[model samples]
Target chain A: MDELTRARQKACAGSRLSFDEALLLYRKASLLELGQWARAAKERHSGKNVYYNINRHINLSNTCTALCPLCAFSAKQGDTRGYILSPEKVAEMISRAMQETPGLTEIHIVSSLCPDTNFSYYTDILHTVRKLLPHVHIQAFTPAEIIYFTKISGLSIKEVLQHLKDAGLSSLPGGGAEILDDSVRQIICPDKASSAEWIETMKTAHSMGIPTNSSILYGHIETTEQRLAHLFKLRAIQDETGGFGAFVSFPFYPQNTKLAELYTIKPLTAWENLKFIALSRLVLDNIDHIKAFWIMLSEEIAQLSLAFGADDLDGTVGEEKIIHAAGAKSGSIMTRKKLNDMIVQAGYIPAERDSLYNIIKQAVPS
Target chain B: MDITLDTIEDKIHSGQRLSKEDGLALYSSNDLARIGQLADSVRKKISGDYVYYNVNLHVNLTNICIGQCKFCAFGCKSSSDKAYELTKQSVLSRIAKAAEDPDMKNLHIVSGLHPDWPYEYYLDIIKTIKANFPLLHLKGFTGVEIMHFVKISGKSIETVLRELIAAGLEAMPGGGAEILDDSIRQILCPNKATSTEWLEVARTAHRLGITTNASMLYGHIETKEQRINHLLTLRALQDETGGLQTFICFPFQPKNTALEDSITRTSVWDDLKTMAISRLMLDNIHNIKAYWVMLTLPVAMLALGFGANDIDGTVGGEKIMHAAGVSSQKALSKNILIDAIREAGRIPAECDCNSKIIRTF
Candidate 1:
């Protein structure tokens, strides 16, 4: 009978709505109102509390050939700035993070897609990181990176993942997922992972019991439909894997990169940025955590995002270089105390956690 | 109308509020105009018809910074020949100059966290600007600089902000949020403010009733999930005090920054989609600014329909983001801004930082 009644009916039946119907909520509701509804849905599925883990990201190298236009992290093969962390060096970083933070849980390892490197090189690094810090979980590689690794290792995705898992690869980080729509991918990052490949890799990883994270790189050259398609695709996969732990949304950083030059200086609006995060929370019902990356969205929005739909703020990052190279202005490295204080300020209990979403400590404010 | 409201509530409980599934139906329905109508309707419902804009001018107090962050093209080493920090006199002069402009109602004073400036130096800067342009809305300092100022001034963040607010500081601009993902930050800005510290500053500022604007610098190496994390952080903070005045999303300007050599581009289509999505998503925030300077004029105009209500005013002189190379030079005149709004088929109105309309142009 009424719009609100219809909306409720759709929700009860788990029936989908038309875009026009969706937009009506936008016209008829406030973010607070919508969030309350979403929060209810969330609590029905997931409790109010969200999760984060104590992790370290060890990017193996910055050298790559994809040269995606939106990338501010990848360097040309021969660029003086290009670098490749030797397996020993990678292991050393892992060991240092493990030792530096005795309570460390996950070692998130990833790097630019370098054509010169092979999967054996990746396996060696994984083994090295694992050997040096036997207790730390390792969540490394994207579908693009994994596919590249498989190609280099001459193994199928399953075989490569199995080898890495045995070598201590605990999980997979959802990276290089710009938009699931191929048209946007071609315009922005043609040489990188394709939609099918990216999805397939996640699916395969899930099948292997290697829990993974999925993402959508929005605020780039894609239509509204394209962004939705990306979400639907992730939802589809999560429906299958039940392995995705979190859904992260990255905005296209149009910094001093070629994309800025080509686009003649344009970026997303703040409302758009929040909408992506909120929508991610709304659409990906299967996923548990909605994270707001401070390094990309900045600290203020990240903090505000907690109320919108996000439950988790990522851990104390020791050193972040990839997005910074893309013109991220937020600083790297936060003490445990600082993170706890932030959570408390937001009126939430801070739970120090391990990679698999295990709380190491509760209400830990430094 | 009563039934419509009820149905909307039902949709909310069903988890079919505003997902892609709905967006697809909207797009395929071949009724694109309804997109704007719905977004505008949401705008009216949440914030009313009152669109907001700030009469602010960019006053980058300094270009010197300690951290040689790879993404920055604007910050220079203090010892470098390119480095420059405005003297109080110069800063006063710039404020005076902006104050001279008839339309300049706010003065945005941001800068790199210079190594040499004492914390009092910032307080004094605020004092100087406020003393001269008492009427100007003085929104200044980023969280990074605030962190630096706290260390330099040897005072707590609350103390420094209180002192500054006493000296006429109205608000803080939320900058330096690259991504909430610490992994990305560690590699990019090891020497800058951590995500935790930045949030502390904003949260404290909010607690103090000093409203601020939040931002996100995206289109780089972060994953989609990280972006979500960034928003979640902001949302969480807003849930506390509702202190944020607006959210401004500007893409990273990579021009001559250290990151230039690493990655080379961002996109425009992504920008519009992001604006639209933001309109649909941030149901809490009152206003979203399509920063005309960062997004340029044409797209900014188009964005008004995609869910953006405010086109950031014509900045008289913009540095920092522009030195990193943004579009839209020269201050935007009221006529131009209104014309652009009218061109986009939206009513144009001049408003204060609080989204309260000062005049219907």
Candidate 2:
């Protein structure tokens, strides 16, 4: 039989498809067959469910010490547009959310690796959120932030996580895991956490039972193998701790980033985006979910991903700065009804879920 | 726009708790990616990168049922073509074969309400397995089956559960909770246990210290509000008892069953959304499962990202979902499961009946 047929047979037989076999499938398999296998595999677990959540995102500050070339979101401390939301300001934002959207389940807090912010400032934000909205889940900070916290606090990673957890920090987001390989990290985010540090922080978090999400930033300054290696590294860590909740892939948006000057970067094609999502499904078998971030992929492609092994459309983000800073024009905010409509239009069910993939509400297609 | 998107974003950033109305507004909003992002954020907070599974074998003791629920394709009349009950020897043999695999840590046994079999027969099945395989965790019986046993044996729900526990029943499978609304249950499964009875059984199981899983079968005649109510009810019970280990959802599959013509199968989107919403709503429940058999493996894997942290594992000889025209593999090899979990970028760990990790792959 041909390689595709052989792979299909192996998949059908419930056998583990080898890496080479997966590579072959990626290179040679028909999109239709791949989608069928992916959809079948997805349905075996999620069935008709497509999960989304409602929450606000807080990019604590744009000021940073490690201004990675791939980032357009960060600004130097004294830069004209640089500003940090103080703990009180953060509290005001969260209180307003509670007053407006009483069902708000989470507050996603992430930021650049700002050198000016001390560890206490970070913990203070957590404390403020907790004191104001004790019931809301606080999903804050990234590995990069943790590493930064360690530098400022002079504490171990474990200590930082403990303090954050004590301050009512719920969990970690999977940002700054742009690429797990050192080579890619150096090229993309050199001043940030080394791949080793990122993995170490995540490992430490998992060991502490602090669940975190995983992500890969691709489509810039990386080879196919580097991307594969990034996934493999994440898979390896997941195998070790079983702590990661979801794996999200962000295609590089070169619109106005510093890296755009050094190298010409074109956006990933729809085919490339879908293939990455599908391959992620096929390769990251140990991980339960893959997301097509609609902010990066656009609504059309994100909807198509339901068939391509992505069961999540990210969420009804009110404001997202990172990708938009990089010149993403797909608009930062989406309404819940619009998200549901997209999923329904894509012939899948639209579900409103929490930060942790819990179902908040399920929308039936009309 | 009375409530601009910015207002919601401001509220969320301020770390405010969302009310039911706010939740409805967010659920009905036009931003799909933002909702997904929020769910992803919640998923990261609760489950982390570890996607849990177990190496277990499903052994259905019998398919014969007295109640002909409209959505059930596995149940049959005693005289039906698929009606067959396993003898004690046969059941023991199946367990023996399954136990031969050293990794087989759990034996999940759910059966139809056999009219002829006495309570002793059911007890014997568990006793036989436990007697032969002491190390194996035996997770058996749904709320419906427990109710059936209670009726047949004239025993209280607690008494039946206690007896089953004594006979090696480690946990209760959260089945037959199709929808906790009596109106829908009357239409879908009138002859089965009422919503109260199912909740009572679950509460009894929890009270006896035998943790149970909970499930919802949606996409039939139930409205979205009813679905939300069902989740809220589950959350309230979980708050009271903390007896639920996981909350799983089944999309209504109408094929080769009495409801086939009346209701079509739920779309995969609906299934995914339900799982996500369940994760968001059922905050007290830690684990949410995506049953690959009913959902298909791809959707289940995608569910890992949506909100579900557990995929009910390596089901050897699964029958109920298959009876409803499920086309996925009946059983998955441990390696295949590990690979699937790894492929999804999650940690794959073998869990016992209680969702305790046995080994990480």
Each prediction's DockQ? Answer: 0.04, 0.01
Summarize candidate 2's per-residue lDDT along B206-265 as a digit string, tens digits: 999999999999888998778888888898999899999998898878888888998867
Pick by DockQ: which candidate is best?
Answer: 1
What overall lDDT goes with each candidate model? Answer: 0.72, 0.81
Please state the CAPRI-style docking class of candidate 2.
incorrect
In candidate 1, which residue ranges exceed 4 Å CA deviation?
A: A2-5, A8-29, A364-366, B1-48, B52-348, B351-361
Q: How close is candidate 2 to the true structure, as a TM-score?
A: 0.54
Error of 1 at B54 (Å): 6.5
What is candidate 1's local distance difference test score? 0.72
lDDT of 1 by residue, B208-320 (tens): 88888788787777765566567667777777879877777777778888777676445554455456555555567777778888877656765676677788776776777
